[model samples]
Target: MASRKAITRSQAVKYRDASKAGKAAILDLVCAVTGFNRDYARRALRQALVPRVV
Candidate 1:
């Protein structure tokens, strides 16, 4: 979802700039709410997300 990506990207700044504990907290919240894959979330937050080609 583009909206999801937009939301994630906005939060990406926080995620990328966050402290260790903050990053973990954000990841936990995101995962809990969106059921996003941890690894994928990590990538997205790093601005490394690419659309799936399936």
Candidate 2:
């Protein structure tokens, strides 16, 4: 079997931008596409959505 690829920061950023839907949908899509668990995807998406402190 092929190895699973990890989601990159850029991809997470893109996912954050693409999540125009509600949080549930965003989490669903993230988990579905990345094959990440629900909790992990939620955390990643949440982190990506947060504004960075300069």
Candidate 3:
């Protein structure tokens, strides 16, 4: 299957600097869209927020 993680980075744009309630809301959205559990969704969003080095 293709990567299920494709959308997390895009969503992370809103995730950065979100309030606690806002983050929870994002997590709920992400979990609903991506079929990832809360912890994995949180980790994916955090990873996506970072600037990757080549």
Q: Which candidate is the best by lDDT?
A: 3
Q: Write the per-residue lDDT of candidate 3 for residues 1-54, one digit (tens) a residue.
A: 135566787778788878999999999999998899999999989998777899
Error of 3 at 15 (Å): 0.8
In terms of TM-score, how similar is model 2 to the real structure? 0.50
Cα-based TM-score, every candidate: 0.73, 0.50, 0.80
Task: Tell me the whole-model lDDT of each prediction, alpha carbons only.
Answer: 0.75, 0.61, 0.85
Better of 1 and 2 by TM-score: 1
- Top TM-score prediction, candidate number: 3
Tell me the lDDT of model 1 at 12: 77
Give the local distance difference test score of model 3.
0.85
RMSD of each: 4.1, 5.4, 1.9
Residue 25, model 1: lDDT of 90
